[model samples]
Target chain A: MIVYLLCLLLFCVGLYCILRKRNIIKIIVGVIIAEYAVNLLFILVAYRRGGRAPLHSPDAVIENMVDALPQALVLTSIVISLASTALLIAIAMRIYQKYRTFDITKIRELRG
Target chain B: MNYFAGMIPFFVVLALGGAFLVSLAGRRLKIFPDIAGLLTTFSLLLLSVLAVIAVSGGGLLVYSIGAWRPPVGINFVLDGLAAFMLVTVNLIAFLVSLYAVNYMERYTDKWKFYTLFLLMLGGMNGVIITGDMFNLFVYLEIASIASYALVAFGTEKHELEAAFKYAVMSTVGSLFILMGIVFLYSYTSTLNMAHMALVLAQRGTSNILLMVSILFIMGFGLKAALVPFHAWLPDAHPSAPAPISAMLSGVLIKSLGVYALCRVFYNVIGINPALSSVFLVLGTLSMLIGVFLAIGQWDLKRLLAYHSISQIGYVILGLGLGTPLGIVGGLFHLFNHSVFKSLLFLNSGSVEYATGTRDLNKMGGLIKKMPVTGRTNLVASMSIAGIPPFNGFWSKLIIIIAAVQAQEFFYAFWAVLASILTLASFMKVTKYCYFGRLKEKLKGVKEVPVCMKVSMSLLAIICILGGLLILPRGESLFLGKAGYSLLKGTSYGNEVFEEVNK
Candidate 1:
């Protein structure tokens, strides 16, 4: 229960960074943090007390095993976050080249 | 299995292969990208028509991946709703690609454009058909990433800025959706949507289900550009290249946002009165606020972008009513909006092509110089504004009537108010952009290329005739079945499982 609360804390921290930071790079990091928090929560949800790896072997008895599905899913989720981060960074780089600033306040060319 | 059933996975495969092949050979062959794009989209359109026919025969088609049965492995399910979305998506894709052949010449990397366009198409088709929750996320990410890159394709200051904002907001939305999926998986221990639905029905509602619903509403609401989460759309839609703008506004939002939301809420999680009321309030807010904001915009494409939000409000409002007539009106309006909105965007693209300006006040009397674009724009404006004899009118009327019948007279009044405001704003568009005396500097502007003219006219013709889709004969094949599927709600689980067992 405490660990779940801690995960929620981490997510809140990331959201705070995103909503409060003016630096584009900081916001990207915040996004990364939030994504990692969710991924961690997923992994934690799959964990079981006194569980071993989900594997099969001859002459070995399987008593308790952690869920393996979420481990696989988390791996895919990490890959997707990597792609999104890469694209976000690339766009940030171009934005820097054009606006010559890391501050989002300075990048206000598009508005109503 | 029917031969048509075998064609399900090909929608993704063909588009994915075409994207790769275009990227591979387009450098050497100048015309390869154009031909490959047109062919791939045309074929997908043909397959979607067949899908509609297959569904009209009154059975769901389930294709188990690797021959692994459901509740164990990933699968693709096709029903009335999927077929409806497929047809709408692929039709816009084909027409938009047709327009891109000419409009994209102004850009440097035409091959890259085709590659990303086809990739986005593949992702959307995957999202529409996939039956696994995680697979939907994968495909949704694919589509979102492609669109982010496409929005920044120009790499200009405003383009990069808009793309950056769009990317950040959309990525956050995806993470929310992923988190929701994780909660659901932990609850049901199954990823297959049909199986999950069955489990959820057995387990009944819980607090976690409530949490997941809120997460999904926030996530898909951002993607759909509901009023509260709509900051990214006005910037992102107009920043992309024109054909892309049309594609984004026309079909991308509907498929990824609206379609996914409906499938998950109505089918997997099941809707309650509370949820329906939430949808109703949100829809009403978006409808009024979106049109109010739109009437003040002077940028041609930006105005159209805001209208996308207002129009989507109508769709959500109809679906929120949760009645047969309401769903029918919503689905019909979804199709009609795709037609005319794409036409409007394409018409904007054509005007920009010849005049090199998207400012409504910068030029006037384009009807004399660019007759096709001018006339098509007029038709689109009328259709979106809900003038009589056009498709928008019939759908809006249905929604209003449905709202009244549902005894939600307040919502019905707001819908009518929005429709009148829409007409007023569009009249402002025509008065400022098309009807005044030809500006001296714009006198040299000529009609757009043949391909663009053809595509715009095609969409305009659809706009004029789109009302017929809700007529008795056409409704049974298209709109009626789609609405019936939604009306079935959580019984969607029973239907899919039955089809799978067969």
Candidate 2:
């Protein structure tokens, strides 16, 4: 239960950073943080009390192994997160080159 | 014999292959990307047609990966809903690819555009077809990330800013979805959607499911550009090039946002009283707020983007009514919106192509020089404004009728008022841009290229005849089946599993 609470706290922290931060790079970091928190939560969900890995063997019995699905899912999610992070950074770099600032308020050429 | 239904992966493989081949040859051989892109989309068009036929005749087709049967292995389920969505996704995809062929000449790396475009298509297809929860999340990310890159494809000042905002909001939304998936997997200990639906049914409605549903609403609602979470759309949709603008507004949001929401709410999680009320509120909110926001915009694409929010609200409102007639109306609106909205965006692209500007204030009397573009824009504008005999009017009429039939008269009134507002705004569009005196600076502008004209004409024809889709014969194969799938709701799970076991 504490772990779940911690996960929520971490998520809230990331949300704060994203919502409140004016710096583009900080927002990117916030996204990364939020992504990791969710990935952590995903892995945590698959955790079990002394559950063996989802593998079968005729001769040997395995006990107390971690749930492998979320681990596998997390790896894939991490790669996707990495792709987004890289793309975000690249776009930020371009924005900086054009606008000469990372402050989002200063980059307001587009409006309704 | 039914087990060989595992050919689902081939679509993704083909799209990925097209991406690779385009990137490899795009630098040295421009013709290669054109042929490859066109051929790829054409094949997808054919595949979507086959899928439609298969769904109309068969009940549901489940394709398990690696011959690993469901409840254990990953499965791709193609039912009427998936098939309907596939046709919409790929049909627009093929059109956008065709438009991009001529429109992308001004941009530098045509290959990168096609690559991201194909990737996004592949992601959407994966999302629509996958029958597992985690797989859906992964595919959603794939599509979302690719779209983020595509939005920034221009690398301009505004493009980067919009892409940055889009990436942050979308990633945040994805996190929420992932969190929901985590919670759902934890609660049910199953990834297969049918099996999860059975488990959820067995457990009945719980607080946890309600929480998951709220999380999903926030997540997919952000994608769908619902009223509260719609800050990124006006900026993001207008930032991309025109064909892309069309694709993003035309079908991407519908597929990723609205379609996913309906599937999860209706089929996987099973709709309930609280969730139904939630949809009602959100749908109404988006409808009222979106049109009001759009009424004041002068930027053509931005106005269209806001209208997208408003139109999506209509779709949601219709679906949330939860009657068979309402579901059919919503699905029909979905189809009509794709047709006219894409046509409108393509017309905007042609305007931009000719005038090098998207500001409505700068364009006037363009109908004289660009007759094809102007006439098509007129058709699209009329449809969007819900004029009689066009596609949009029938759908909006059906929705209003459905609301009234369901005794949601207040919603029906709002729908009527919003439709009037739409007509007023679009009237402003046509009067200022197409009918006024010819501008001094735009005297010699000619019609767009043959390719652009051809694509725009094709879409315009559809928009004009779109009312025919609701006719008895047309509805039977297309709209009827799609609506039936949604109306069936959780029974969809039984249908898919039964087909799988066959």
Candidate 3:
């Protein structure tokens, strides 16, 4: 329960970094943090106490095993996050090339 | 017919393969990207027609990814609603690809554009057809990520900024959806939508399902640009290239956002009174707020983007009402909105192509110079503004009548009032952009290219004929089946599972 609360706090912190940071790279890092937090939560959901590896052996009796699905899901989610981060980094590099600044406040060509 | 069912993977493979080849040889062969993009999208159009025909008989068809049965293996479920959505997505995709043939001539590395566009299309079709929650999320990300790149395709200052904002917000939304899926998976221990629905129904109203539903509402609502979550759209829609604008507003949000929202709420979760009320409030808010914000925009695509939000409000309102007529009206409006919204966006694209500016203030007397574009704009504007005899009027009228018949007098009143405001706004658009005196500075502008003109005219013709879907025979084939699926609610699970087991 405390661990879940800690995860929620970390999620909120990442969100705060995203919402409050003015640096483009910082915000990207914030997004990465939030994604990791969610991924961690997903993995944690599958954790079980005194769990053996989700493997079968005819000789041994197994009492508990971790949920394998969320781990598999997390791997996919991590790959997706990796792709988006790469794209975000590429876009950020281009933005720097265009504007010569890392501050999002300085990049104000589009407005309401 | 079974061979036709097996062709689903072919469409995905063709588009992705073409995208891959284009990206590889884009530099060496300039014309290759254009031909490949056009051919790929055209074949998708053909497959969409076949899917529609197969599903038009009001039965469900399931395509197993690897001959894996449902509740264990992944499957794509095609029904009336899915077919209708596919036709709308691929239809616009083909036209937009054709338009891109002419429009992207000024841009270098056109292959990248085609690749991202096809990837986006593949993602949308996957979303529309996939029967599992996690698969839907993966497809949604594929589409969303590709769209983020497409929105920033120009690599200009504003385009990059808009893309950054769009990418960040949309990625966050995807995380939320992923979180919701994790919760649902943890609770139900199944990812297949039909099996999950059965588990949920047997378990009955667990607190976890309610939580997942709220998370989904937020996630998908942000994607759909419902009033509260609509800030990203005005910037993102206008910042993209014109064809991208049409695809983004036309079907991306609907397929990714609205379609997913409805599928989860209506089919998987089973919409109860609580969810219905939430829909009602959100729909009404989006309807009222979107048009209000749109009335002041001078940027043509920006104005149209806001209207997309407002129009989507109508779809949600109809669906939320949960009556038979209301469902029919909502589904009809959904289809009609895709048709006319893309048409209007295409018109703006043409206007931008000829003038190189999207500001309405800079584009006057274009009608004198560009008759095809001007005339089509007139048709789309009239249709969207709910003028009598055009497609928008029929759907809006059906929704209003349905609202009244359901004895929701106040909603009906608001619907009529919103329609009038819509008319006023579109009138302002037509008068400012096409009619009145030709601007002295804009005298050099000519009509758009032939392909662009052809695409716009085809959609405009559809706009003129769109009201026929509500006629008796047309209703039975299209809107009726879609509405029946929604009205039947949780019974969708039974139908899908039954078809799969067969």
Candidate 4:
């Protein structure tokens, strides 16, 4: 329970940085933080008290293995976040090149 | 039956294959990307129509990967709903790609655009067809990332800024969805949506389920641009190239946001009174506020983007009623919105193509110089405004009637009020953009190319004929069948399992 609460706290920190920070790079870091927190939480949820490593071998007993599904899911989720992060960074670089600054408040060409 | 069963996975393969193939072949041949992209989307359109037929004949079809039975391996399940969404997505994709062939020449690399376009198409198709929750997330990210890149395709100041804002907000939304899925997986010990539905039904509702629902509402709502979560859309949609703007507004949000919401809530989470009221409130708020904000926009595409929010609210409102008529109306409205909205965006793209401006006040009497674009724009404007004989009217009327039948008088009244507001704003669009004497800056404009003209005309014809979908035969074949699947709700799990066993 405490660990889960910590995970939530980490996610909130990321959200706070994302909502409050004015730097584009900082917001990207915040996204990374929040994303890793979710990944950590997914891993945390699948941990078992007496779990053995989940590997399939001919002579090894496979009892009480921690749920391996979420581990695989988290790996895939990490890859996806990597792709998005790369794309985000690419866009941020272009934005910086165009605006010549990283402050988001200074970039206000698009507005209602 | 077996052949149709085999066609399910090909939707994903063909789209993804087309994406990579375009990238490879486009380097050698200048026109190869155009041909490959067109053939790919045209084939996709054909497959989705066949998919509808497949569903119409058989009840449900589940394609288990590697012959692994469901509940363990990834699965692609196609029913009336998936087929409906596929047809909607691919139909617009084909037309938009057709328009892009000519419109994209103004950009530097046409192949990159087509590659990302096909990748996005594949992602949307996968989202509609996949049965696993994690697979859905994967596909959702694929689509979202592609759209982010497409939004910044021009890489101009405004485009880059819009893309970054959209990417961050959408990534956060995707994380929320992922977090929800993780909790669900932990709770049920399964990732398959159908199996999870079974488990959820057995376990009944819990506080965790409530949390998941709220998370989803935020996640998908942001994707769908539901009012408060809608800050990214007006910037993102208008920033993309016109055909891309059309695609984003037309089908991406519907598949990623609306369809996912319906599938999860109605099927997996099992709809309840509290959830229903939540949908009603959110849907109503999005409808009124979106239109309210739209009227103030001078950017034509931005205004259409806001209308997307208003129109999607109608869809959610109808689906939330949880009645057969309401579901049908919502589903019908969804289909109609995709058609007319794509047309409106395409028309906007054509206008931009011709006059080199999206500002309504910058041009006038476009009806004389660019007759095709102006006329089609008028048709689309009427359709979106819910004028008689156009497709939007029938669906809006159905939703309004359904709302009254469900005795949600306030919502029904708002729906009507929004429709009227839609008319008033569109009239502003016509008066400023199409009607009156030609503006000084627009004197040299001409009609668009043949491909664009053909696609826009086809979409307008569909808009005018869209109401026919509500007829008995058409309804039973497509809209009614799709609505029926949603009406099945939690039985969706039982149906998938039954089909898999067979």
Interface quality of candidate 1 as DockQ: 0.90
Q: Which ten contiguous residues of candidate 4 chain B have the minimum total lDDT?
A: B1-10
User: How would you encode candidate 4's per-residue C-alpha lDDT over A50-91 as one tens digit per residue?
Assistant: 998888999988888888788888999999999999999999
DockQ-sorted candidate list, best first: 4, 1, 2, 3
Tens-digit lDDT track for model 2 on B82-159?
A: 888888888888888888889999898898899889888888888888899989988898889989999998898889
Superposed by TM-score, candidate 2 places the C-alpha of residue B120 at a distance from the truth, in angstroms, of 0.8
What is every candidate's C-alpha DockQ against the true complex, given to 2 decimals? Answer: 0.90, 0.83, 0.77, 0.94
- lDDT values, one for every candidate: 0.93, 0.88, 0.87, 0.93
Of candidate 4 chain A, the 10-residue stretch with the lowest lDDT total is A61-70
Ten consecutive residues with minimal summed lDDT in candidate 2 chain B?
B1-10
lDDT (0-100) at residue A11 of candidate 4? 100
The A-chain TM-scores of all the candidates are 0.95, 0.90, 0.96, 0.92
lDDT of 1 by residue, B1-502 (tens): 6567678999899999999999999988999999999999999999999999998986789988898999898999999999999999999999999999999999998999999999999999999999999999999999999999999999999899999999999998998899899999999999999999999999999999999999999999988998899999999999999999999999999999999999999989998999999889998998999999999999999999999999999999999999899989998899999999999999888989999999988978988888899899999999999999999999999999999999999999999999999999999888888889999899789899999999999999999999998889999999998998888888888888888787
Tell me candidate 1's fraction of native contacts, as a decimal between 0 and 1.
Answer: 0.86
Please identify which of the two predictions, 1 or 3, would achieve the higher lDDT against the true structure. Answer: 1
Runs in model 3 deviating more than 4 A are B1-3
For model 1 the local lDDT of residue B269 reads 96
Q: Please give, for residues A12-102, the per-residue lDDT of candidate 2 as tens digits.
A: 9999999999999999898888888888888888788778777888987776677788898899989989988998999888998999899
Residue runs of model 4 more than 4 Å from their true location after superposition: A56-63
Local accuracy of candidate 3 as per-residue lDDT tens digits, B172-259: 8898899899889889888999888888888899888888988899899989999888888999999899899999998999999989
